[model samples]
Target: MGFLPITKEECEARGWSQPDFVLITGDGYIDHPSFGTAIISRLLENRGYKVAVLAQPDWNSKKDFMRFGRPRLGFLVNAGNVDSMVNHYSVFKHKRRTDAYSPGGEAGKRPNRAVIVYSNRAREAYKDVPIIIGGLEASLRRLGHYDYWDDKVRRSVLLDAKADILVYGMGERAVVEIAEALDSGIEAKDIGWIRGTCVKAREIYMDEDTVLLPSFESIVASKKAYAESFALQYKNNDFITAKRLVEQYAEGLYVVQNPPQPPLETLELDDVYGLPYEGTYHPSYEEAGGIPAIKEVEFSIISSRGCFGGCAFCALTYHQGRQVRGRSKESIVKEGRRLAALPGFKGYIHDVGGPTANFRGPACKKQLTRGGCTHKDCLYPAPCSQLEVDHKEYLEILRALRSIEGVKKVFIRSGVRFDYVMADKSDEFLRELCKYHVSGTLKVAPEHISDRVLSYMHKPNKRVFEEFSSKYKKINEQLGLKQYLIPYLISSHPGSTLKDAVELAEFLSDNGFVPDQVQDFYPTPGTLATCMYYTELDPLTMERVYVAKTMEEKKMQRALIHFNKPENRELVRAALVKTGREDLFGKLLRGSGRTQNPYKKEPPLRNQKEKTRSSGNRGGQPLKKSNKRRS
Candidate 1:
């Protein structure tokens, strides 16, 4: 079949009595590697299992779920690449106008808490089918986590969706294992021994290898217990040294999570990405102008997976794990040559990066064998002494890609770790990046300026960003390039006081840098920052953190970034007055006269990886996504 069967007719064309699996998704079907639904479906098909695709089915009734009837094995459900709630709503809890994952960039195509709704619908369609749920939404909500929308602790998605088993993290390995066991006639509830899976149980024989977290009732009853629970979940994410973790929901009921599956090695990652992908959206979606999300990755190549650049608001720790993995250069080059032959092959290759572009390998040699240190981060308060910051392999891969027959330029659009760049003694990689990779402007996330806020965000201090800026400027000057650095900053993050927001505004004013996009702290699930947002205490430190909870304060904090804008004068004034820094208000707001604004217009972004659109949440892709929410 050109694409996986999305209808009963297509399934019949495949000459199969029934599909072994029906993969339900919230996104328009685009059989690309960046999509989790594609990888799992193709992998199952390659393994000789009949897999059918069901993309964004109507959720009002069970009619759409009956398109393929019941699968022989199970129903694999995912809430697209992004969390449905985050996709549908902004940080201000306002509804988003459009969705990139849907055809025609439409909104309301998928329901909120899509995994739960789809799972329930699947049950209504087939009362006795084995339902398996995984993806960014399901993975992050595998256990009891802070639900930002509900404003409280919600139980595991496994419970809410009534799923038989929940597969967390990258599901390539665990998915196959589950399929084999199910094919062997094992019940979903009994197939709980596999790694990277969570299953419900009535009783457990406690052992030294099992770590029990505080019960859900205890957490809901006490914020201290909730913080402690989050801390324990944070520490056991490593594959090598992690043990079985259990969370109690009721007296006899429990959710048991096995240790994470190991990261895929070079050849393994190559096989996963080397599957037969149709590249573009399914032909049926052409009438709707195709998926807007595919535009970002159609010309791009994923060279690696995983990240060690620990940020508090990021969900990578729970999903991809900290151990990084890279595909072989040969595999990447092969994909590039194939992309070059495609009908819409352009002269430029968009990106050749993954979670973190420059991280082609593990943080250090020790991570491969012993795993990351549970109590320490690879790059956070400071770069670890054992960090290996060589970028030779990544450079070689980029060179090979750009040298392809039809390739003109290769870009690294997935973002880079500038702190890691500074850790390297030699500036060879920096020089090359400035010379070829940068498209006039390189966007990097500095998150916040104040050391007080930076501590809570797990980002490097302001001085580190300043030094990197200086080095970047010097390197570009030597290369005779007119490049600029777009620093990504956040507002209203936990522990960010009015004084700290004023400090950030002052820094932006002094540097003549007016950022068009400012992210108010979005409290998504399975993040340290989200935990802090709910508990008002740092999960790791258990110290009380100041949270900007009120809507007025969040708006005021965001207004301070662009204080010179005439529309933001009143909010900026309020922020300054609240911080008791009224003395500098005259200097900061001096240009708020009838002259309209004082800042000059920025130069064209020149087909750069990202730019500050009219609204970062709409129109096109945003520049720096500090939070990692991929399946």
Candidate 2:
């Protein structure tokens, strides 16, 4: 079973045998957010198509096709699964590496190894079947990228995965296009015209190449570049540059950017809610795994898609859109009931959230049929007036799900928009949120505490996060929930400097959320923040600003926020002195070590000779042409 599976009776009624498609995942881990495999599978099944999911298959054999025999439809290969996952490297970064070496868990297993494994099995078993690749791994790696570890350029994931077609963006609409075309006797080669897809062509025109440029791997070298390429710009629905990249590189790559899907109409919500669901988690849960956070939770559900915060480092807005599309309250409550029925199920449900769980409606209904939205937002910085600020519907759903039989406690455990909550200013909503959704702690991102950086990132000001935190604390205290806010902070975003980072560090120290995880900005392609990161711009004016890209500078800023701890104190002091900020070292060292962060001990140097050689070359000039030629 995949994250969401269709019932056998439904399959029988659809006049399908077994399934027309079988989806594959990597990492071997199943039970996760209804990601690429889950959503894609459900969509096809809803159309009376037969579908089956092989959550994580044994990588040992090509004969694995015998497991499913043959499907009348085709194959949907989602490397988005455990085995196919890559870390924060941009498409360009992926291309620069020697083969596919992902350092972040399940990656870096050896160059070109993941593709070889999936492709070899598909080629051997389902030679004639259409194999469509989609999801993060395939989407990001669809073009060449810079390989930070190996320091070289590489080919796109399509060339590597050898799948028939590569789907990009939020895949629902394009997926429907593919299915419709395939059902009508269209081949994979014809899928290029569909938006949000990348296909293969023998030749491409040079002048028109920008739209089809295979530079995805090349563009993501800097966090800022990635942010600018994908992250939202206020009021802007699409990240223009990211869309351009898709159009340019899409020529040769059968990639399509299907027009954005519309928000679920009111009348359509009931049918979605009426779909049969089984909450029993998939059996092959550990086929592949990474990111301990997913494993930590027992179960999870996507309550909605898309966000409106317009953070420069985030890509969700670009791909999923800012408009909120949600499953009906009945649907969610039904899923909750299923999970409770699972044997050995604890009383607690891990998570019930989405991109921004509290958000539950479209950006605007007028934009739906007009095709062109004049609102500054959905395109740039003004929030459209048509955007509603309502939590009533979402709150009702939450309460109903909690009432489901066997469900002990339900948690709202994904990204929460504190700014949105503060805007509603509803004490009833706040109190309900604190008492029902939280379990000890709630996670919220206030990417930075600096005024300039916050503006640059399109995030709400620190003042808002602070007010929300204070109010949330009050609510928790009144309810006796013992909850606290786990503020997620990002470092090294565009326009963020040592000075700004220091301010953020001081704020964190003063606010008493010490040693929390702080991310080193890794620019994802197709984000608005990437432009700022690459250019270091003013958030409001989009004017150029200063940025720090060096590793040492990044480490020092990271250490400052955790200076209260002994291990981080020395690191922060060393970093400060190195960056000419030694004056703050004394003040930073005043706090005593309180607790240890979860960190693995580094291994000793494998060879002294390698270390000596590296140290000797630290500041040395490059070898002369003659010397190089002689060698």
Candidate 3:
């Protein structure tokens, strides 16, 4: 229930000569369920293991790794809850100024590739100890993956780190199995059959039931092969139907990824969440203002896991898969009471949701046994008729939380799938959401408005969003409550061209919505969209797609979303001219007619007639002659 030992003095104070496992991480040690290191270490301790944490250790030398004095079990390493590359750099590959996971919001606390660096250091400190790698970075890069930062395909993290084993996904089950095997005298290299793990093999020794993907050489040699390999990897991620996948590397070496372990059932998930977490950063960080990351999730409850809404731009499908699982309502309410009892209880429970807020059970009954459909998405193009669309259990849980004595309001900050809401035959959930849960502005991701772009993103069409918007407005009107929908949009996603950007801009203008923040498509590792960004071909269809790779084009695409801003006039104008879309130039300029141009020097105009035409047009609506004054 207390904090794990992070120093030798603490270990000695616990009357222990040595710890069982020295868990190393990139982020500062925050003993909270929201942190992967906290959950795994606490689970190990609960199972009668002495776990010492070495968080954000100095990666330059082996001295820090030796502080634990060689754990009896082994070393467990992770790049924290987020990928190291993403944590260190922005989507633009620029260095980030702050790390919420570090003390004092400092940068450069960990190395660029922390897992690889830490594992090699552990080897140097203790030559015979087993090293295991897990968490988001290792899980997503378990196989050869396209690294956007490096602009090339990199080998598996296991290979680069030279670790004995790699446990991918939610690794509670895998790590326990690994510990038992290791404690029973099984060597790390010899233990290869465990589920949700990846190990390097010296030769091809897989059984008939295993699936073989394209060799690393072949994928690196041909983009088509890489796409094909990724498709196979994506399809075989389900626990019920997945098979062991093997990919060959040079000199007869192979990386074997065992089938993913089954998702935890209601009771198992409840037990996992009920683990005794200190619920905040370690006291040592108090002097440096603590880990800022804990503030977001300090009072929130993760009620569920996995998402059926498979967006190409998201990595959840590859990491968590498509099956949905939830804890019992009793478990969630108990956590809510605990949150309400915290010292700074504000009577407001920040969130009671996970990957997707509204999802309570599996997408459909068939998925319980058959796993998700390999050929089709659960909620893309359209919701499957077989999809189970109900929010009864979720509503009940929310009601129970609200009834708790100290609880005032429970807000669902994690996004709800609006399309899923529209799929429901009843409006009870929508009404309750607007009346009780909304924090004035509900944030939802519609990504882009163009169906061409949406199709590539594997998101629901624009019509679905429109339907949801209308229903939301009607409910608000009926309740006499004023709430707004803040939609999250993306620019320069694969299959988006200047024409598509213009279409999305027109949609935003019509809706009178100017997003304060816009997300340019970032091609992180292991997502389907990242594959498309690197290959310029949809892995599913093998069709060529347009990609805006140039900085100027991407800036223009992002600028189009906020075309009403005076500063973005020149970028919008350049985009229109380059795409031969001069007709849209008039609409962009006239949408919010302003006199002051932000450009220091005026560029030459096309002609007097062009200027006159632009002044008279108001985003396709004819302006009165008296209102035709130019800036």
- Return the lDDT, model 1, position 518: 64
Residue 70 lDDT in candidate 3: 88
lDDT by residue for model 1 over 327-387, one digit each (tens)? 9999999999998998898788888888888888889999988998888888888999899
Order of quality (TM-score): 1, 3, 2
Expressed as tens digits, the lDDT of each residue in 556-628 for candidate 2 is: 5655665675545545556555657656654566673533332323334456344323321212121111001
lDDT of 3 by residue, 1-631 (tens): 5899999999999988999899999999998887889989999999999999999999889999999798998999998877888887765666777887889878899998889999999999999999999998999999999998898999899999989999998899999999999989999989998999999998766577799999999989999999999999999999999999999998789999999988888999999999999898899998998888877788889898888989998888888778889999999999998988899889998888888889888999999989999999989899999999999999999999999988889998777899999999999999999999997777788989899999999999999999988999899999998888877787889999988998888888778776744677878777899999988889888999899998668777877887886556777777777878777765676654566443333565557344423321222111111001100
Please state the error at residue 603 of candidate 1 in Å: 33
Worst 10 residues of 2 by lDDT: 622-631
How much lDDT does candidate 1 score? 0.85
lDDT of each: 0.85, 0.56, 0.85
Query: All candidates' TM-scores?
Result: 0.94, 0.74, 0.94
Task: Give me the candidate number with maximum TM-score.
Answer: 1
